[model samples]
Target: MECAAKGLAGEPCAGVAQRRCGSCGAVAYCSKDHQFVHWRFHKEECARLATQMSRIDVLSQFPFTFSVEPLALNHTLPSMRCLFLESIKVHLKGLWKPECICGPEIASVKDLSITAEWNMESSLCPCTEPENPVTRPLASWEDYYQWRSLPLHSPVAVLLHWPLTLYHCLQLSRIQTSRHDGHATLNIHYLGPEKELLQLAVFAELLALFPGVHLRIELVGPAVPRSRDGEVVNISSYAHCSVQNCGCRSSTAPEDLNSSAVTLKLWKGLYHERYSDIAKDSNPHLVLAPNAGVAAYPSWMPTIEMIREIGIPAIFTDFCEEAAHLASCCISYITGQPLGVPIQINPFRQPIAENNSALYIPCYSNCFVFGM
Candidate 1:
């Protein structure tokens, strides 16, 4: 009997299951799409079923041996992906829980997909800091790519000019999926004072989706007055954090109608250390390193070895492209592949070490998973 796999977006594929996985007939899928979506999820199951169906130790005799990491026995993955992350084992000390990286939550996927606005072959100059950085408008990817090609020096320049890329990445992570518990936590290194306005909008929309909210923020840029040890400010106390100024559609508010429930653990200086200490209370699922080096916190960059150890996917806006390498490593670890031409990169930079792995989306995204 053919093994008809169930599709995540819709109905089960029962059409004469023609594609056979591995040697035995125990696991089969009716279509390539069905097969792709089910692999990481079913790989372990396949091994068990294979033994019952055959006498040949199929995997044992094979040239490849994969030492799998321990996944949640609960199977509460955050997103639905075909090829999930698998890796060699390493350990770290953190109370954080793993989250599934997912695609855009907008009703229309077509709205977010890469558009043909730039020829992509056009010349780009080295990126530099804008004379006035705060009010810089976001650029389309084509223009961003074109500018990044120039002999760019500052990571700050990339952050100033490329808010759209960062915004899309935020959307792609779908970073705010609330658990059934009605609470969720996320971490974003506030890129700058102006960017805080945007972050407020993003967080407001995210918080409105759930009843109770726990926000952990690491503030950067010239916006917040610097304190050496950092400060914890309740966002509700800030006038700009109000629902009206936040520009969100969510109607949920505190009983008083004036106080926001959001909390901001704002800080600066030695972010990785500060962030780690802060994480003890509310473990954040994602980190926003949009600028990468300076405000994005480059010293905090972990080697590919460390990333495989943690088993968490990262979203990068390291306009300088270093974060891309780290992200590429995350993708490679999952697929057991070597780095190559990434699906995308800023113009005029060497490819990051982690390139061309299963972690990549076909265009303009890393760690993308589409679930119905």
Candidate 2:
């Protein structure tokens, strides 16, 4: 005999009395196919019964009454008494909430009162010009409702694979499930001219999915003129941002290589002094100098001819404009342990103090440390 749930060869285990559970014998299985293939019949029932059996299992450990069915199934059971007694109804929804269960709404932030009204004016970064810095402040504790346990929204879930579930939790936290009513509209502000407003709006919708972020879209200045092809012609014609473009997805290589790795060759240059211990085959990470002296080097300082001699596949990106494209390409390939290598001097600089943890490669001066 074997346990259907554990799939371990052993004595027959019964879950629902004579019925054995298809996945785990803690319950019942109608047939092998039903045990493995049919889920529509078992999912909700299993969750409900699992709650009951688990209660029975726990109570059996104590001197309390043997009957745990009421404890498990009752909406007003001991475990749920306080939650039900409370006047406020707590709800969960979105990626985090299943069925968008409605519950009490709670204020998430605190309120501070000013003794009196006063205003101060100061010239600040245009980014700091928003009239209201904080929106959606918590109103009161009356808004909160307690959750009983994890909600069942998906058909299949595993416990040991908690990382997958935890990531889901993080994403679900962003959904204001209680505000599912069509009336709840969020105002967004984008600091650009009218021409670029459409693109910014789409980006903001995506950003809203990030937790702890709220954006208010406001167009800062007049609209910029555009060419017939919908391209902005003048770069500096307006004050608010115009025609902003990024190399985040741009590539110089063929389209097929977008998903593959590219080899990197390390050329020796003024950065050579720092590479003394680093094997020519393995490019050394860089360190930036501080006010200690003139430390700025061209992005191509690492692209010397000697690097290509190593016979490793590599790409050449000397211009700052190309850094984003290069980084995107390399990162996409290195999703897991990758075979190829990439060398670039455009490593962002870390504060000098943070570099204390790593054996510091020498720098031309003292202000910054280049990271690999």
Candidate 3:
């Protein structure tokens, strides 16, 4: 870790940071002098970080088998990604490589032939709901896992964060489900999709989660493949599980399947660039951007302005608390209003932590969520 303190010339101190902040443990300093120099600025977020650190156990809870493994025992394992890769017997070389200081980007693993186990079917579709379908909001991963009858060994956590985060955003917006002939419809404009485009099928889990709701998600992003632009994928049924005797396979009858439970429309380019065309068709109930570095990207300004003018409930998630805090400030400045939903730790944040964070802060995909 590098020192968090600034030098006399207003540059970063070129000192090896070995001392951690006692209260929060979220940052480090090169020496006592540097620590004292950085205290004025660090004091503001120290308590908040302490509170987050206090809840580390809760934040780290996940159903994956890796969660129970002895990650802490491997002193040589640099980060969670290394442990995961090691567990899968994949070396951090050749086809598999680290993507950033955050660690290897799970999205870069595109060889389905090799990642078959990790890319297991959602097994959510064609399922029999519990005697009474869940109507109340799900508050945690454990709640969703129990409700869905998911095994603790399941590896879905790697990809389920996409839909789960969306579900959490809807809950934050308080968008009530209205039934019409025993079915509900939810329109969502999912902005800034990147790797999600390749794993769209995972989103079919939304059908099972929402039960009777038909989800129409418009994916708008620059990462959208040009050839796939304007393509509409209607997922009528959930992806089949590899397990032959799975409950969903046996319990669901052929006639019970809906024609289309989730419809994904792909649009190329930035949301603001094509939002006018998108709005012409249907107004979204909520706008969601997962891991959106709002303050870091200048492109988000137009979208923020449009969202403010249109007055739609928009939610954004970031990898760290500092990013979320900056994003919240950016939105507040753009909208000229207080946040509709204040910054908070997302209960459904990705279980794996990003190591090598400069601040030593706990960072994860969809770590902190806020809205304007």
Candidate 4:
């Protein structure tokens, strides 16, 4: 009893004589009054410890040794469950590991056999229009209806918050205001060259085959990349920031099928090889060049007329500050995705949320609807 009390006080309790309390074998007390005084803290622990001891049905099954000290009790259980589950998730290509699940038997990625490694030309971003003509042929309702009925194939909306994760924002727009058919209209805000855009474009092209499907992808900001010569490049030069390491986060709205489902996607779009250039640039909007094609900044990129046409009010900011805020504002909309960037506790690993109060998240079909 004396030894146990000393141990709880962080003192050496070994080699002390053992004295048992008459009331319960679950606890030890140095003296009669000490036992009575310590009863409050010990009472809860005593019941729990007693129940735990009673539940030990297969003590002899495992050859591990045991001790009766309360502090050491926690370490007796297996810790491998967490490691094993994490390993299984990595094997299954899952972004997030669920809590308290059994692990699947699979070798880690490091153990996998590989055939070959090749260096290839980066694919072009297909989401934005080509650079040869900066002026978008005005969107004609006649042509819009034709394409609208043709099939709204792979339409993705990417929202990203900057300075946290490398990649961000990639989503397929669904109908935002309508109910009959999915009448999602994608508006291009800003686009950087990233391979995911090409992949999305490929998906859109493939989805064009379905009936009553017309893809309307939009860029809300000036979707232009910088050229090799420090001028703005074409859309193809933009890297898919969602998958690439562009240090951004993304969000989207719910995809409602009953009404026009607005499926907002967030992913990384551009990762310039030159990060220092981004750091040195004074113009926040001109920080990094998209990984797409080379071209001059066309007149159509981020003009006041574009915002007015899109019905998005002008958002004025103080130079670089506004750009930083805009980056954060864009990311709040993401809800969920097949991919997840690693989360870290450090401030360096946290995404730059503009207001840090706005809630924008992407949604999955499997997730429970947040609101009716």
lDDT per model, in order?
A: 0.36, 0.23, 0.72, 0.24
Per-prediction TM-score to the true structure, in the order listed: 0.33, 0.15, 0.77, 0.19
- Model 2, 1-372: lDDT tens digits are 222333332434344223456332344443454355435545645554444334333222322121212233435423332232221121121111111213222121121111111011111101111233323421111110001011222111111011121122222223232221232222221111221222121121122122222222222222222211122211100012111232211313233321221111212223333233334222211111112111122332332223223332222221121222334344333333231323222221111111111111221111111111
Q: Which stretches of candidate 1 lie over 4 Å from their true place?
A: 1-167, 174-214, 220-228, 236-253, 256-261, 294-308, 320-372
Segments of candidate 2 deviating more than 4 angstroms = 1-372
RMSD of candidates 1 onward, in order: 22.1, 25.1, 5.0, 21.2
Cα lDDT for residue 117, model 3? Answer: 21
The residue-by-residue lDDT of candidate 1 on 1-372, one tens digit each, is 243355552767758666767544456677887777877766765654454345323211211122223344545544222112311111110000111133222222222111111111112211122223223322333343333342222122211223344344445555663442444444444433323322232233223322244545555443334431244544322112112323222323356422224544545444444545555654445545443433233344433233335443444444322234444555465446554334343331211112222211111222221100
Poorest stretch of ten by lDDT in candidate 4: 363-372
2 against 4, candidate with superior TM-score: 4
Give residue 283's error in model 4 in angstroms: 30
Model 1 global lDDT (CA atoms, 0 to 1):
0.36
Model 4, residue 305: displacement in angstroms? 3.5
TM-score-best of 1 and 4? 1
- Model 3 whole-model lDDT (C-alpha atoms): 0.72
Output the number of the lDDT-best candidate: 3
Candidate 1, residue 145: Cα displacement in angstroms equals: 23
